[model samples]
Target: MNEQLTEQQINAAGHLTIGGCDAIELAHKYGTPLVVYDVSRIRDQIRRFKKVFEANQVDYAVSYASKAFAAIAMYQVAAAAGAHIDVVSGGELYTAIKAGFPMDRVSFHGNNKSADELAMAIHHHVGVIMLDNFHETDLLSQLLEENDAKIKVMLRITPGIAAHTNKYIQTGQVDSKFGFDLASGQADEALEKVLANPRMEMLGLHAHIGSQIFELAGFEGVADKLVEVASHWQAKYGYQARVINVGGGFGIRYVSVDHPLMPEEFVDAIIKAIKTAVAKTNLDLPAIWIEPGRSIVGPAGYNLYTVGSRKDVPGLKPYVTVDGGMGDNIRPALYQAEYETVLASNPHAPIEEHVRLAGKYCESGDILSQDQGLPATKPGDVLAMLDTGAYGYAMASNYNRNPRPAVVFAENGHDQLVIERESYADLVHLDRPYEQQ
Candidate 1:
């Protein structure tokens, strides 16, 4: 049995259940390579993060990083959960607008934001623009002056502390490509620039350590570093920050070996660290904002794939191929990501053999799992891949001209199709025959 599943997750038919809906039935109805989300899981994680801040009597915002998984339905669900959102691209912002989400609750972020995207964010009155570079700062300043617009902004600084990654070195120089480096005084330089522009309201500072983080030391280091920066700005420039955003990268359980802290634990630690840091300074306690993309939706999502063929190599792990491949979820092929899989019909069945879970994509690297232990499964057996809700569909492509899979939301014994499967015509909808002159 997969450790991620509980006894209650198995229905009377001996099949895995998602949000009270049977996984087998979902596969039959939606077809293979489908993505399913347990809506309650997302809702609960958001609420839990909020309650922790509220319980501590601290003001906060649980901003969902939409880049993890962006769609109109996802935006709607996030809005319903009272979550602010972080959008890196215009398409995600447009999706949130189409979902009727409040624009003021949106934060636009990107390393190199286009002029058009900045114009869109300002025109729509997005809550905050995470200024990443001096070029972007100048561009936004010019655009704001031309449009006579004003918007709240934050300086994204590289605190140089990342956990569970090779970039864990914390110093003045950062190895990332995202934000302004603090050690080089670029963060201070950017701040002075933002303050010079009347159209940009400098709210506070922002930093993202790393993704798939499992430890708290990195976050604690960042919390203290952000406060140190804020204190320096307040003392030197007489500037007071209202909000401190330590950007998202919270980890979630993709396999049994992963043991991430609860959302409450992570929030509580951050809150305490900020409070403790504030006690050492004359500055007021700023509102803490956390962006949790993977933690909020990763555990809630599952990918269902239907088995198609098999190849038994001599004395090697048998190849168990499925209908979907890198086109649907490219994490495995791109970065050698790991995930657990189970038979939808009997999630708790005894392991019969170890097989390589291969994808149907043409690429030789389209392997879903290198060594997946599973029960005896024949053709047409549905395999439920766990913890794929974060980066799966968001990175899906029309590789090999395969249409992306549909997405479904299940809760309280009901299932609703949120995103429809792309049609074959959709693959060529943007095609135009070249006319040689």
Candidate 2:
């Protein structure tokens, strides 16, 4: 599966160095179980995606889906790279606001937004609010009318195109919880209700099929379906959606078994599909928007863990335990996903044996990798797992009283700690003891 490290990434000590910082040194300074993001790689990815849209003559808004990894530093980096932010929750919105992200460039999305959340979005003057259902539309309209605020909104529709990915992430299917159903005439009704609201300006239609999708055909399918609905709206009401957001599910190369399409190629293919569909529909081209979370930041991140324990299971396999487990990375146990790992302390070591990577969690199922071939590992050896920036920390848990790991950025030979390691006291910071009378 070609699990060797790149030559340019190898350092004098025979260890992998990302963003000009040695992984081993980073582990020592930031402590074990650290997430190190390569800022240059993230910026380059953003530019590559944007360039393809620009070249294809597609007016687009490339929003970084911040649910992948939302932090002040990450938000700032994404904003600085000229990518609009897509926040899915109130907390994500707060983070972006604290990072001083331009509200005009931010888009808020959620399936069930509370009245307070709607009010916050109105106060912040976010660029767009992607309404997921009739309830949200009603709530947003009420808030806007009561507060005398006008909002730009997009109707999120389920296009009934089931993407090839984990079933948990599929959103465009008819029965999915995310968007308005397109097959049952509910989407039309929702559109009618949205248009009736005087305070809300319906800007567009948005659809996200699923996540971890590897082929471009699925996206093409989404584009076709969206254009079909968009044409109907134009014909019925003479109101063409100004923007069409085909939400992002561009996959990444998690292991050799998966061959994900490149970001630029995926974007180009989607653009071509949209143009073809629009040509047939005889409708004006709307500004296309994409919300890419994983592809933009996944490969740019590497999680370093210090080996802590070793176990030899008779007639089964050897187990190498690290300081972190499902608490930090739940993909392995959650999705039965595979990840490639290399020894940061000995990047050039030959793969000599197969070992199961276990996390330091109480659950027996808290494993990081199963039946993985790597160099004979020992305690204190640093292991680097590639492509962890997307969901690793964002989905992290405090299970088994394990504190979350720290996050850092390594760029141009300089390493800066972006998030401090959670301390034991930080664990119970929200707890309070009751005083008995």
Candidate 3:
């Protein structure tokens, strides 16, 4: 059972421990269907990414793309760890503002930003606005002109590099709904428009290849393309762009089949590629910015659930149903993602049996794991799923009218409940009952 735990995690006293907290005990005290985050692991990941920038001797901003899992507490933690933040919508920006995050350290990004969103960002004095399309540029330009505010902007470009990942998560390819496409000259046209606007400051270019990418080749390819574009721009314009944001889609290992690069290796590969391309093109190093979401927080989170019922399908498979399902974690149902699970109450048990992990949701598609190996499972046993820190709670929905799970932070043998469990009344708080007159 201990062998099944990740290198940074441990199992003690027939209980799972993450960042040194008893998982069973945490579930017992905090209640089942809980998201427990390892504070130390989050800090360690932040430091690891920062060290990469330091090692490369490059001015960089490692922005935590909170779209992975954004909450007030998580935003504050990222800010305290000395990392900038990336918010895609007004809701995330509002949460960050409520957390009192530094306005100057925030970067706003979106393909379809509303006027109110742009106004909020300008009022907050956000550091950069990552323009996604021509409409967004025009809208932001109008907002800036009206407010008479100076805003730094980065042009998000699709470099036509399709990374090896799920097609749904790939963003750098030609067909993506994200950045401006480089091959069709849309990226150049976008840059020209931004440069023409006095209120909109053309900082640099940004390109994101994809999500959950295991290899570094995609990043290297994008870096080469972006640097070439930047050099060409520098020759046309008098000054070299001051910033180049290689957007974040670095991968994290969710199970045995997935193998993502470590922070050091990923950063080193990008830096080497950028250096080579810049040297080859005779251009100076521009400030680098990365918007990593899953990699920074995925492994740091664990979803703790308690087994409620067990059923064996004759000769097909055994099903272990937990109290929570798609309402708390929808990745399995949405993307057919696979996850590894362990019985926290029987850490020493030999995993010799295969079981299908199911959630309590009424939907048949609410399966968490299919044919997952585990020690013989029993009713009332506590189980934990690893690498859920990214899309788990962030993508949670109140399907089947089930309330979402609570989130906790644990470190140094101490655990604190950061988010209170949602109640039935809380779920309907937004509803207004009306009687026919």
Candidate 1 structure quality by residue, lDDT tens digits, 267-307: 79999999999999999999999999989899999999999
Q: Tens digits of per-residue lDDT for model 2 on 334-392?
A: 99888889888776788999999999999899999997778888789999998888999
Candidate 1 residue pairs that clash: none
lDDT of 2 at 343: 84
Summing lDDT over every window of 10 consecutive residues in candidate 3, give the lowest-scoring window. Answer: 1-10
**Selected candidate, larger lDDT, 2 vs 3:** 2
lDDT of 3: 0.87
Candidate 2: where is the Cα deviation over 4 Å? 1-4, 435-437
Q: Against the true structure, what is each candidate's TM-score?
A: 0.98, 0.98, 0.97
Clashes of 3: 0
- How far residue 114's Cα lies from its native spot in candidate 2, in Å, is 1.2
Please report, as a residue range, the 10-residue window in candidate 1 with the lowest summed lDDT: 164-173
How large an RMSD does model 3 have? 1.5
Model 1 global lDDT (CA atoms, 0 to 1) = 0.91
lDDT of 2 at 91: 94
